[model samples]
Target: MDIRKATIHDIAEKLKITASTVSRALNDNPRISDATKKKVQKVAKQLNYQPNHIASALRSGKSRLIGVVVPTANRNFFSSVIRGIEEIANSLDYKVIISQSYDDYDKEVQTVEALLNARVDGIIASVGKTTENVDHFKKILRKGIPLVLFDRVTNELDVSQVVIDDYYGGFQATEHLINEGCRRIVHFSNSQNINIYKERKRGYEDALIKHGIPVDPNLIVFSKLQLEDGRESMQQILDSKIPFDAVFSSSDYSIMGAMQVLKEKGFKLPEDVKLVGFGDEPFTSFTEPTLTSVNQKSIPMGNFTAETFFEILNHKDQSNNIPRKTILKPELIIRDSSINKEKPKDQTNLEVIEK
Candidate 1:
C-alpha cells in the first residue's frame, strides 16, 4: 500500500483482476463497470497514487493551457479585450480557460482559486469591478506562475500590468465638453476599488480645477458602472433644474443611455447638449451622432496581455518574479457628438484661470 511502489499491477493483483481492467477502471472508461471503476479509484486514492503529470508534461514540453479572468465576459469592453487575448493565445498554441467575476469580490476570489487548482501555466486577468483585495494573487505569485494583469489592476501587487492612460482619457473627455460650450459639465464617477475609474474621476476633477470653473459638488455623481445607472442618473439630471449643458461619462454604455434619454426629452446633441464617453466602444460610433470618446486600443491591450503572460511562462528560468508592465496611451477620437470649430493638441491643457 506504500505510495511509492503502488502501481496498476498492484491494484489489479489486489482486486484479483487484469491490469487492463484496473487501468481502464482508473481512467473512468465507460467499458469498465461503474462499480469496478469506483472500487479501483478508491483503492488507488487510498494508496496515495499520484499520476505522473510532471513526467508527461515535461516529455512533451507542452501543457498548452492558459487562464484568463475578466470582470464580465459579456461586457463589450471585456469581450473585445478577450477577443484580442484569444487571437494571441491561439497563435501561441495555448487554450484559455475563461471566467467572469460578475463584479462580486468573493466570487472573483473563488474563481481565481479554482483556476489555480487547475495549474494553468499562466494567468491574464482584469480584476473585478468591486474587488479591492490583492491576496488572491498571492498563491499564483508564490507558486511562480506567470501572471499578467490588464485593464483593472492592483497597485500594490507589483506584477505585470497593461493599461491605458485612464487619467488623461478623462481629462480629454471633460475638456472636450468645455470647448464645445458646455457650461455645466456633469461627471459620472465610479468607486475606488478599481484604479481605472478612480483615476478617471481624478482627471475629471482636475479639468474643472484647471479651467477656473468652480467645481460644483453636486455635479459629480457616483453610480454603478452600468447602462441602467446611466439612464437613471441622466433621468435625475433631467429632473433637476441644475441647467446642465453636457455629460462626461466614464463608460460608453452609460453614455448611450444618457444620450437616448436626452434625445427623448427633446434635447439637441452638440447644439444644446454635448456628450462624450470613454472606451470608444464599437456602438459609440454607430449611434445617430457618432460618440466622441477615448480609444484605448482594446484589441492590442488584449493581445499584449496574453503575449506578456506567455513570455513570463517561458522565461520562468530567468527570473523568480518579473515586474513587467505595459502602458498604452488613449487617443481622443472626435466624432459628431462634440462639435468644436478648432481642436488644438492638448486643447484641455490650459483651463481658463479663475479670478
Candidate 2:
C-alpha cells in the first residue's frame, strides 16, 4: 500500500456525490443530511484526511497555539512559572511557544511582533522592567488576540493579569527586620520601573513608616540582580559612614552576593546584619545561614496562566466587562539567616562532667 495525503476528492469519489456536497457534509452544515455527514466523517477518518487549520484560520481568524513572553529564562522564578504553563498547555492539547524579553523594552516589542507573525491564538506575558509603554502589546490586542499579563504588569493597559502581591511581601520582610531590632535597614533592589519592584518598594516604605523608623534617602540602593552587583553595592554601603544593621534584597542572588561581602567584612548573620530576600529560588535554602525569603508560588502562577488562557479560548473567562487581576500572596519563609531567636543551650551540662 502507498501512503498519500487524503483529500475531499477521495470522500466525494467514495460517496458517489459531488465534491461540494462532500465538503458540506464534512463541515456538518445543517443543509446536509445527518446520514450524509456520518458517512462522510467515517470515510474521512478512515482516509486520515486532516484539514489545514492554517488555511481555515486565515479565513476565520483563530489558532490553537498560545504565545508566552517572559523575562530571562535562566531565572528559577520564571522557569518555574513556565513549567506550570507548559504542563497545563500539554494536557489541554495546545502548543505554547515561548520567548524571553531579557527585561528590555525593544526586545520585548520584537518578541511580541514575532509571536504575532506566528499567528498565535492568545498570549501570556510578564512585561519586562523596561516595558513602561505597553503600546506594543496593545497592538496585538487590536488584532483581537486575548492578552494576559503575569508577574510584572503595566497599569496603562486594560488586560487580564496574574501576579503575586509583591508590596505585601516587602512589607512583611521589612517589618520582620524591625521587629527583630534592626535599626538601619537598607533595601537593595534591582529594577525600579516594573510593578514587582515598585510595589515591593512601597511596601518597604510603608513598613518603615508604620514602625516609626525614618526612611533614609541613601539607604535604598539600586543594583543589577547579579553577584557582582551585590558585592559592589555592599562595598559602597560599607564605605559610607551610614551604617546598616539589616538588609532586604529583592532577589535571592543579590542576597547571596551581599552575604559574601558581609562575610568578608566580618559581619555575623542576624547579629551584625539580619538579611532577607525575595523570590525563594532553589539556592535560597542551601546557602550558608539558609536565606529567609518570600515564596512567590512561581509554578502556581504559570499553571493559573495556562488554565486561564484555556478558559478564554473556551469563552469561559471569569469576566469581560471588567478586567480582573488575580493577585497571589507571597509566603514569607523565616529561615536561619534572618533568625534572631536565640537557640537553646545544649543540655550536655546536665551530664555533670561525665568521665
Best-matching candidate per TM-score: 2
The 10 consecutive residues of candidate 2 with the worst lDDT sum are: 346-355
Against the hidden true structure, what lDDT does model 1 obtain?
Answer: 0.80
Residue 52, model 1: lDDT of 55
Candidate 1 residue-wise lDDT at 242: 81
Candidate 1's residue-wise lDDT over 223-267, tens digit each? 884788889889888777788888898988888888988889898
lDDT of each: 0.80, 0.82
Q: What is the TM-score of each predicted model, taking all chains together?
A: 0.78, 0.80
Q: For model 2, how does the per-residue alpha-carbon lDDT over 263-345 read when each residue is reduced to its tens digit?
A: 98799887788889899888987988888888888888898777767766677442453467877778888887876658531
TM-score of decoy 1:
0.78
